[model samples]
Target: MRTNYEAHDIPYRRKKAAGWPGWNSAEEVHDCIQTLNGLLEPLEVASTADVCEIGCGAGNLTDTLADRGWSVTGVDVSNVAIHWARERCRQQNVTFLRGNICERELFAPASFDLIIDGLCLHCIIGEDRDRVISNLSYWLKPGGRIVVFTMCGEPKGKDRAGYDPKSRCAFSGDIAVRYFAKAEEIIDEFRKESLQCTFQQVVDPPNEQASLRALFEKPR
Candidate 1:
């Protein structure tokens, strides 16, 4: 997974034109931004809230949070991605670190006021998904929230062609790359970590790909 992401980041850094794999625009982070905004009101997020964005590729959304006066920490396994992220968002309030989310020591327990999955969780497969969720919960403050953007349910079109139902993974040739978990399954996993699902939305566009956007809150 690490090597695969590192390879993807190099071309992205040089061209900065391909956007993301599934999306068309490089600035297509509006859904994440919008979901986060909705959570702020109900959760009463502080103006200078400390946020951590997991797999913050090129720091697109991380930069926006910093612009809002929030302190942001962006983490990605790809060093190339982290380097580009640091360059893209040079604000003092934003810091980019290269690290894998499955590592327990990537961040101290209760390190962030909120954690954004940044559409990275689905890229993780197997028991690692559980480990990553546990880490996300551990990293959050008592009353913190986690916002997730991920591929969920069934795939469509080309994605469906590559889908492996047994593992819930989408493959590129013989290599398994992405997981498309059921929304209920994901919420159940969060529940196991004692995080409550405050908001959930599944977007399955016609003949296109499907995605899940959700907000989970930790009890105070």
Candidate 2:
């Protein structure tokens, strides 16, 4: 995963855009920013809110939050990405850290007002998925919410060509790289960790697999 992203110049690209090192059209980048803005608008969260973004590659999404006046922390496992994020986001309210959320504690319990998955959860496979979700719950403040945008259900396109039903994962030459689960299954996983599902949107793009965008809240 690290090698794949390290080669890419930017982290957040429109769904239809070509892979990194390939530039997205101005319109596509605008649409991507709008999508991120749309996710936060409905929540009406305060600007004073503290946010943590997991897998915040290049700080693209983190920049959005910081620009909106929120204090933001961006975490990623890729050192290359972290360096890029820091260079991109120079706002005092923003901080970047390099680490795997699944491997160690990134913050104290009840630490953040919001946690954005940064579209990373789907990349986690096996029991690590459960452990990461559990840890995300642990990091949230009472009544805090998590925004998860991830691939769900069966794979499509090239992903389908390499899908493994038994592991529910998509592969690249025998390496399990991405997991796809039913939307219901994903909701259940968060609920099991005591989070409440507040909103859900499942989208199936043309010639692509489905993606789930949901908001899960920790009970106060």
Candidate 3:
């Protein structure tokens, strides 16, 4: 299935050399891990739990979570990212795989207790996003949680370059990304799926970049 999201095809060497901001510095990586930990804390999960991170670039959070005693699985459509994640994490508790969320059949139903989508959802378009959400909902056990972080088009204006009015998706730049909807729209989507949205927070990046963080749960 050829799709407009072709950012994953960039050569591994280039990605390695470019060293995407999120994966390059330890401090930045630590901050993201800490943020995730803080977000998961309010969910009341057990100490020992299974966690899955969709589009876990280079497995930074996956490795961090595994070290904290959670069994972690990281998935990304980029084989380069998957390879780096596997090699970098190298821990018994962490597993890395290359898969696309649009293809729901790649994953088993009711398999994860916590699913995290860190800046990945926006990359998908119209039906693909819905399919991914439906698949995630189906793959989560009752009472499970799903957390998403993305650049929302609210207080912050839309990313004109990133958005494609025709496809209603983001383009494949050096790293392809899509513009996210307003908080209300996201909440509405969750409601449509009967998912209980628990929290929504706005995060300001170091350089004034902004993002939306949402936590939703499947009713038990």
**lDDT (CA) for every model shown?**
0.79, 0.78, 0.73
TM-score: which is higher, 1 or 2?
A: 1
- The TM-score, computed over Cα atoms with residue i paired to residue i, of candidate 3 is 0.84
lDDT of model 2 at position 80: 63
- Tell me the TM-score of each prediction against the true structure: 0.87, 0.85, 0.84
Tens digit of lDDT per residue, candidate 2, span 2-31?
113222223343322343321234564465
Q: How do the residues 1-220 of candidate 1 rate in per-residue lDDT, one tens digit apiece?
A: 3225445555565556554522224445676667556645566678879999898887877877788788889998877777778766789988889998989899999999989886788878778889999999999999999988787888777777677788778777666668889999999999999999998888888876777778998999
lDDT of 3 by residue, 78-196 (tens): 87788787777789988888888778787788888999987777666666767778888988889999998766653234355555555444555533356456657766777687889
Cα deviation of 88, candidate 1, in Å: 1.2
* lDDT, candidate 3, at 106: 71
Runs in model 1 with CA error above 4 Å? 1-24, 30-32, 35-41
Task: Name the lDDT value of residue 181 in candidate 2.
Answer: 87
**For all candidates, what are the clash counts?**
0, 0, 0
Q: How close is candidate 1 to the true structure, as a TM-score?
A: 0.87
Flag the better candidate by lDDT, 2 or 3: 2
